[model samples]
Target: MILVSYFARYREQLNLGGEKLPLDASLNTVDDIRQRLIARGGVWADIFSESNLMCAVNQDLCRLDQAVEDFDEIAFFPPVTGG
Candidate 1:
């Protein structure tokens, strides 16, 4: 399982703070997981529509194609806007 979280505007838009997903699916990378979420339609599509979407794997910066492991803490949020 993977712990997925959303913050800032994304949390409000998705109406969720976080969730857990099974690793049974062939989603080994962040990008793969994103595509699956986009397929869910509604707010998910919007959350993932941007190429600059910020992501963290266990709270560390990570990329879309980055590999993930079970129980990994994955967080998604828009890029920080403050200076």
Candidate 2:
């Protein structure tokens, strides 16, 4: 199983905090998981736009092409902003 989490505005906009998906051949990278989320359409497509999103695998920042495996935790959020 894979754990997917949406943060900040993404959580509110998607009307979900997190979800779990079974790991399979169709899902292999961080981007693959993101594409699946966007397939949900509506706000999901907008919120998960590749240009505006940041992804993390197992708490470590990573690129969309990063490899993923079963039981990994994937987090998606907008780029961080701070003073």
Candidate 3:
């Protein structure tokens, strides 16, 4: 299984903290997982459509192309800004 999490605005927007998804061969990378979520349409599509969306794998910030493995933790959030 893959543990997917949403942080900050993403969590609030989705009204979800995280979820576990069954591991699948088709979900080879972070982008693939994202595409899966986006495929859900509606709010899922809208939230993931942002070009500035950020991702992390196993607590390490990574690109969308980052490889995903079973039992890995994936997180998504918007870019951070502070004064």
On lDDT, the leading prediction is 3
Q: Write the per-residue lDDT of candidate 1 for residues 1-83, one digit (tens) a residue.
A: 99999999999999899999998668889988888899999789877978889999998998898999999988999999777
lDDT scores for all predictions?
A: 0.90, 0.90, 0.96
Instruction: Summarize candidate 2's per-residue lDDT along 6-31 as a digit string, tens digits.
Output: 88888888789899999999899999
Name the candidate, 1 or 2, with the larger TM-score value: 2
Residue 27 C-alpha lDDT in model 3: 97
> TM-score winner among the candidates?
3
| Winner of 2 and 3 under lDDT | 3
The total number of steric clashes, by the backbone 3 Å criterion, in model 2 comes to: 0
The better candidate by lDDT, 1 or 3, is 3
lDDT of 2 at 53: 88
Give per-model CA RMSD. 1.0, 0.9, 0.6
Arrange candidates by TM-score, highest first: which order?
3, 2, 1
Off by over 4 Å in 2: none
